[model samples]
Target: MRISLDGQVALVTGAGRGLGRAIALALAGAGAEVVSVARTPADLNSLREEGGALIRPMVADVLDASFYAQVEALERLDILVNNAGGNKPMPMVDVDDETLDRLLALNIRSVYKTAQAAARRMVAQGSGVIVNMSSQMGRVGSPRRTVYCLSKHAVEGLTKAMAVELAPNGVRVVSVAPTFVLTPMTEPMFANPDFSAFVMDRIPMKKLASVEDVANAVVFLASPAAGLITGESLAIDGGWTAQ
Candidate 1:
């Protein structure tokens, strides 16, 4: 089915490359005029080159609360995708306070702050949808991912909290949690056979999720078809945590 957003405007964080880029394009392709924000100017330029008229690339660090406060300066945004986040391998024992701070700031805190900013605007409009990008790691724990897990677990919690509050104001909050999706950011992991095997070991499907797989879910949740859905984290993982 075609999900239409013809007169809507979408704001997607981290929209320069990787899964964020894919989602931005998908939203635009479905008819929403996209405001693609990212920290990398080169990535934003590439988005404009690739998506042409459908995407309006904005280079800004979403973690910078100041930028998000002014995001309303753009056309009234109807859809907000809190897709910006970063991760690295680190065992909990060796991770220092600074490391934890950075990880939380980039992954979890950014989602909350940005989503809150968008929610404020959405409430004013009396209609809006926000989709946060989370990781399946948020659901299950693994070695060397304690901090990452913590951040995503917070995402799930915040999604629930924000959803209930936002629902009353005509704004819905939700999340998409996926396994290791194949993207430029994860290409390095896929290059190593050991890493590849390790990741596939948990997935009953055995194949890494494609960027499109996650993008499809984002589009659906953003559409009117999912009107009744909110305060939920949709898992697109290939049954990885089912066991």
Candidate 2:
């Protein structure tokens, strides 16, 4: 089925690069006007050039109060992709307080605040879609991803709770949980043969998901095609979590 988001406005956090960049482009390609947020001016400028007029580049940290002010200034927000987050792989015993706080701030706190800001506009308009970026790690544990898993699992719970509370207001909340996707940021991690082999063995499809894979899911979920899909996670994990 063909999905179109013409006339809709989408805001994608972390859109300057990697999966978020792919998602922002995909949304614009699907006919939505996209506001791309990121910390680097150069990256946002690059995206603006590539994405053309449909892309509005916003250089701001998602965790900043100024970011929320910018979001509040938008006339309308039809879709919100909470894609700004990171992972620090370290043994559970090696997890430090600072690392844990940082991950939680970015992965959970920022997501919640961003979604809350968008939800207000959406609720007033009486329709909107919020797609929280999650990870397969959210559903299953890994040896060196204790903090990453914790933050994502919290995102999973947040998605559901937000969905339940906002459904009556015509706002939808969902999550896109992807497996280790092949991106510039992640390609280096696979340089280790042991790590690469371990990951390859776990994925039944024997390959990492591409940025396009995750982007496609986000676009579909934000479109009318996924109208009834809320409070749920679409795993683009190449059968890894299915194992």
**lDDT for every model?**
0.89, 0.94
* Residue 96 miss distance in model 1 (angstroms): 2.3
Instruction: Supply the global lDDT for candidate 2.
Output: 0.94
Instruction: TM-score for candidate 1, please give it.
Output: 0.96
Return the TM-score for each candidate structure: 0.96, 0.98
Q: Give me the runs in candidate 2 sitting further than 4 Å from their true place.
A: none
The regions of model 1 sitting more than 4 angstroms off are none
Ten contiguous residues with the weakest lDDT in model 2: 65-74
Look at candidate 2 and give me any clashing residue pairs.
none
Q: What is the C-alpha RMSD of each candidate to the true structure, in Å?
A: 1.2, 0.8
